[model samples]
Target: MEHTGPDAHPWLVALEQSGLGVAMRQSLLLYPAVEILHIFGFVLLVGSIVGFDLRMLGLAARLPVAPFARHAVPLAMLGFCLAAPMGLLLFATEATSIAANTAFRFKLTCIAIGLLNAAAFHLGPWRSLLQRGEVTMAAKLGAVVSLLAWSGAIIGGRLIAYL
Candidate 1:
């Protein structure tokens, strides 16, 4: 999967050659530290998402959704803030190989779909659920999709090293 010389994508090669990428590859501590941060970020992000999705799916019928979301969403955003930059740095370190990696591609696709699903749910049925104090079918569907997409993302990410 390692693309070199004329076989490699120009932009990816350039990214791998960038100062940040060089540093990431050369530094023993930096890569592991960034990886730990990345893992923590994903844990926070996915944990919050799963908790909220479970609430939407009727796990906590007593507690309100809006209040939970108000707390969870910020944590998810914070997680994203931590994850995204570290993820970029990680990718830069091996842009050529990773961009060609099937698992990496799948993980990226899942992330995109999951984010879109969240955005759509929030913009649409989420508001309805919050305003009416009722869980709509769309809300339930959104929760299911979120769970599947995020799960797929995690699996795909893990498989990247092996695949």
Candidate 2:
């Protein structure tokens, strides 16, 4: 995707034309590294969360489900943190292109939905479930929703670039 519109995305234009942007663009050396790191972050995020969620669903681990849910949060957060800024920088490079793209908007909406879903889980049933000291059908349902939300977010994210 490329930039467009007469207004010329003031933010992106400033970034791309700035010293940092010029330096970033000029460096053929760093782009590949950043891209690879971003992809690695994606793998880590999906792998950690999905693996943890699946384990919580008892689809993988023989042990109890709670630990996976508890322990894997940080790893997933790390991946998300890694990807978020790079994704922003990448988007800033071509904001006008994305502004004209529905799929991009859809992807962001999905991510927001997923995040909100997660917040709901934490603020509601999952909190009580954990405090009660055992996972239940409701907890399992929550896990399933988590898995679906995250999967949706990932699929939508990938679809953004494609569209």
Candidate 3:
């Protein structure tokens, strides 16, 4: 397969010339609706994970970590799934700049780490622990990792526009 240079991608040029991006380029409101959707999705994810993770870490709710995790997993998944498409939408509008940006690379790396963390949690011992309706050391560890990954993803994403 022939790889296209970043500058040569037709998609990138289209995005750069998109009326939406060009119109709001100067205002903080650029892609306001898209950004809003992204934020809303992230908040949902935070709400789901935070609540579940905290409960696993001995917070209120006293939910069996397994059950709590079960419910929270969907929300976390939803949040991430929604945010990803929205993020990609924004990136499409400026792929050339984003691809060369350090913050964007970092954001992508963090997301990769997050996905790996989730997969590891799913396939490792935490899976059985979660099945038992009690939090184990592994569960706590996973929760901490989840918190860090998601938090880092958020920070990296926010920094994208700034940096």
Candidate 4:
């Protein structure tokens, strides 16, 4: 692996040279398996989150948000659990190029934004949602942000291969 410019950093070099990274690159089936797992994770995470967000946005006004959130949030958390470590492993395989990739950076930024939005919502509006018996403007805004952030992350992830 040729390292140059930003990709020449020691940690990136070391990551790409690690046993996990080497194994990922050497075994075609392993890489594909990991990729499939990663895809499954995102599907669960994003799909559940989107469903919750739509509810917050008043898609199914008749359905109580609290119960929906209770069910969906756990799935989102589980998805994150599966995706995060797999993502790190995938990154290890081509740390240098992946680190330098514009799409990768965008995806990371979007993920950070999405996480922060979730945190803010849970800490703020979410606590009152049950008692309030209605979605607050803050919750709606958070839902919109969540939708856009996760969607952008997905778009950026897909573009990573091309760009």
Estimate the overall C-alpha local distance difference test score of candidate 1. Answer: 0.91
Off by over 4 Å in 3: 1-30
Error of 3 at 67 (Å): 2.5
Residue lDDT tens for model 1, 1-163: 4466687899999999999989999998999999999999999999999999999999988988889999998998888889889999999998999888899999999999899999999899988987898999999999999999999999998998997
**Candidate of highest TM-score:** 1
**Shift of residue 134 alpha carbon in model 2, Å:** 3.2
Candidate 4 TM-score, C-alpha based: 0.96
Candidate 1, which ten residues in sequence have the lowest lDDT sum? 1-10
State every prediction's TM-score relative to the real structure.
Answer: 0.96, 0.79, 0.78, 0.96
Using TM-score as the measure, name the better of candidate 2 and candidate 3.
2
**Model 3 compared with the native: what TM-score?**
0.78
Candidate 3 backbone collisions, by pair: none
lDDT of each: 0.91, 0.69, 0.74, 0.91
lDDT of 4 at 31: 89
Task: Write down the TM-score for model 2.
Answer: 0.79
Residue range 69-124, candidate 3, lDDT tens digits: 67888988999889888877677666667766778888788778778877887797
- Model 4, range 1-163, lDDT digits (tens) per residue? 4454663799998998999999999997998898888989988999999999999998999998888988999999999888888888899999988888899999999999999999999999998897788799999999999999999999999998898
